[model samples]
Target: MQARQDATARAVENADNLARVIEHDITYTSQLTDLSIQAAVDGAQDADVMRLPDHLRRELLFDRSATASQYIGSLLCLDSRGKIIVDSTSVVPRSVNLADRTWFTVHRDNPKLGLFVSRPLQSRLNPGEVDLMFSRRVNHPDGSFAGVVVAAFRLDYFQNLLSGVKLGPGGNITLLQDDGHVILRYPNDGTPVDENFSGRKNFERFRQTHETSFLGTSGKDGKERLYNFRRFDKLKMIVIIAPAARYVFADWTSRAWYIGIVTALLIVGMLFAAQLLSVEFRHRLVVEQQLRDMTRIDGLTGLSNRRSLDDRLMLEWHRAKRSGKPLALLFVDIDRFKRYNDTYGHQAGDDALTAVAQAIARNSQRPGDIAARFGGEEFVVVLPETDGAAAAVVAAAIHAAVRGLAIEHNGSEHGVITVSIGVACTDTEEVTDALGLIKVADQAVYRAKASGRNQTSMAEPFGGAAVTT
Candidate 1:
């Protein structure tokens, strides 16, 4: 399928080159037409050419010396034909009728040759008058009517012009009539074609896009030549044709099966390489993220470990120190965990630790606060921007929350897991060292155990001042 598309694309390219060649020919012809008519119009605008005798019109038209040195030669005239005025050395005349034409109208209406333009065509000639019409009109200085100017090729110009142009090697370009009739062709397919084969079953591809197409056979010689065709809207349907296999690019596409195969393989290889690289990268990233998470998490309980809690305490301590705000720390431990483990199995002890860790995590109120299992049955919390008073309230809440747990603790004194909490508050002076705050909070936890288990206790803000209950 790709090979087929490649062939089609090559055919289109061949057609495009053909169109350009034709367009170049048209442009050269149009420019020549314009220059010649301007010369004639200059003569008509002159008092000499305008007022000269009809016999003297030729002398004035062709008399370059009569004008300044800047003027080029004028359009040459010939043909002893009476009604069909003939021209020599210029464009191909393809249409019939000249006098009542638009060129004549615009020539009469507009004085500037630059204003209006037309395409070349056959001239309608009659016997007696030897008349001719023009492809374009030129204007007089005062906007009055000027005469028509037609091309008079030097000699067999169309034949010579078509023959001289070089299409790409393996590519052959040709000119045609609107009906798909060959007017000019490379490799010289001299057979004349019908001028009415347009918009038909035979030439549907060419009709659609003015594009190049490959037909099976030209049928004239039944030879296989790639067919690229174009039709001119301005010329009432003149067509230009070119064949593939003569142009250089056509040769490249001749091996399209091989070329397309290489390109497809390269694309597939690149995609597979990209897929492999992405899979490897994703696998590495997943493992790396798990490693990072494990460093901060307790293995037995899914809580932030002690290493993370130490970092969190220092962070809150520094924040309180700079802002002159307060920081609070809570020290938590499962009441009589060692006794419970001795009485029950280590598995039961593990269950008690998990329940205690959950209770502490649930009690942390703010997102900025830290809740971590600080090794064994001990847990710690860091509360930022909180004073001694606020910390006490939070500590009380945690104490109450743990006591209310309905965990089935067969070895616990309270019939379930409970934690004793020690709250310590710090001011800027005491926050100088985060470890100092942890030590005081730990000492408070010892006080809670000494006074009575399963209760909340607090330490001084900075100095060893007596804490109010």
Candidate 2:
């Protein structure tokens, strides 16, 4: 009896650990794909972006995809009319209209929806290939609906990610959205991906806890199994690991028949299995740490990426709104950056960008402050509980730091690397949401650039005149 109990406990522990590892991997992939989509949304906001030459527009909207090509199948920007405006895979937009698609209609009808993950479906661009889309709503400066930015992930990529796990005999792994729709299942059981399991007793029990292990009967195969499941904190997804109960106790059952003769051998075998599990668990912990770092940090500048910035912005926005405090944003752009890149090589341009990023990071020293590389030649700083006056001071400090670098850029009128900064604060009623604050700040940057390239500009109330600092 004791041996059977030990076997069952080990199986449960293994399943729980494996489920955690798989959950972290899936979450990281989803966030990375969403980041790419957000970048496209940001680029799409420029009304003239779609009018640029095809290659130039594609590079601006889809440059992030190059870093994550293994997971993202394609990045696309669709117009408000649901016509393909920009596609990452080709220079010319495809003749595809997604106006009738559910994903498109959901964002069009709901302006507040942030990111939406869709069920697997056949790809219109790549016939016969299945894709799962990660999408975000794009909005015009006045907060009107613009379009949708999509990152399509090939289903086979997920299959390969989960296929390496050695779930023992009759074991299975399932990935489901929070709504109980199955996204993927291991062993390719021929079950449809969209099958709804929310009505099942097993799924209801799994949803009862954030992380847990139990023994249950498989709804599909009708076999008793040890089930371990976990749900993500912020992501709308759950992971389940189940291995047949008979297989879990097979060794213990055999040992019980010969307890008098092979008792010592059984003890040694159990110890060996326990040691293997410990090693595997430690290895997975290391992998999870690496994945977490990759998801939050930008590869080029070593600062918080757009994904991290978006999360922190929303968090601070809500906190300030509740506390009746102010939040500030700075839009910093390198002056004459394209001219610098044309004069020097791309390597020199990269060095200049890194130097400018460091300058911005130095001035944003508060605990609640964050500086992130928004995209090429641009950066954003979030200052929680800060007013317009204080934000302008920080922007001035950033301008000074960049001048201190003294990086020579003969392409500029100033003969040195300089930055144009746009500052905006949520002290006025004009800014209703986090995205609105960003728009105001971005507009201020444009004003700064237009007035002259090397000064600070503060945003007036939305639609009001620009204020020079």
Candidate 3:
């Protein structure tokens, strides 16, 4: 009963943390998009890009493109009548009318709205690909509506932001309009998935707890997930980070297997000893088993400690060499964690660390995947038979899981807790020792931390430079 209660509490806490992390990231990105579109409007006004002749509009767009790197698609300036006046990607003067578009209509109807975000739609220019538009109302000097200035960012832009986060085969992250229209889902399977939860109880639940997280089942995939409903009011959307329940409890499942085997062995030993040995001998055997278990687990996080990880890594390393398969190692560190400890006190810091460890464990789904608390705020994962690309997928999942924790951190630039991950993998012939693999992974971790926190970096097998993702 105590174990069950503890597990429930941890699940609830993890759900809340994941919601906060998604909210923070979506809010931050929305603010950036708002700023980007606003800047484009200001730039258009300053450069007279809107009023320039059609022949020269292309030139203006070229100049603008040279200086900006924010938008993944293109920028557009539309006339009050809905005719395209300037397009950044268009070389020929194309006659496209975007007057019927929601983004354009919303701004035309409500000029007071600083920015308008559209639901995911098929791109008019980039056909077959979905796009989300960020638009701002462009006004004349006299405050009359001139047109709409749009920054059409491809849906892939948002997808790439989460490309690294893989939650096993069933894990998914979704972005939805506040109205519950599905905008994006990761692991693009090529089938058009209309996962809109609008008009359903789940959508209603989202409206009720826009700032919090709750447990729910996904209507699209039919998986019970820890759901977070975070609204970016400015962007008119909500981001949901939902890892399937099975994946979330994977570590617990692994521990259960270990416990079950040990219990069975102990039972058999006791039965045999009942006929042939003394009672004190059976008690001593039980005590020895308990001691062995203690040595392998980290008390605070309930994860394998460094000692366990070392043993597991050595075993996996030899197995990989014998099978001629790849062995992957990931070194994870909470970014700006010292400042978090200083601000939140050690107890809160410990809680944060525990949460981080749990996130790592949840994402390391394979039975052979070893997640260990490697002292303080650092954690490690040993991925047997996993190549660099596959390890990167795990790394992304770990990043997403930790970011989901969203513990408050006043000192970090992100204003919330985040993690940096370093991934290193070796084919059988690349390294003769596990220590060399650890060194490579450790170097990648430093690179990830140094470049920026909340990102993943990978090291080449043969000690090449660390590459940030």
Which candidate leads the pack in TM-score?
A: 2
- lDDT of each residue in 173-220, candidate 1, tens digit only: 555545565444455545332234445443656666554455545544
Pairs with steric clashes in candidate 2: none
| Candidate 1 overall lDDT versus native | 0.61
Model 3 root mean square deviation, Cα atoms: 43.9
What C-alpha lDDT do the candidate models reach, one value each? 0.61, 0.86, 0.76
Selected candidate, larger TM-score, 1 vs 3: 1
lDDT of 1 at 316: 76
lDDT of 3 by residue, 210-308 (tens): 545566786666778766556666566776676677776676777778888999999999888875766677888999988998999999998998899
What TM-score would every model get versus the actual structure?
A: 0.50, 0.53, 0.49
Q: How do the candidates rank by lDDT, highest first?
A: 2, 3, 1
- Ten-residue stretch with the least lDDT total in model 2: 460-469
Candidate 2 clashes: the total is 0
> Which regions in candidate 3 have their CA more than 4 angstroms from the true location?
4-33, 43-71, 189-195, 209-211, 254-469
TM-score of 1: 0.50
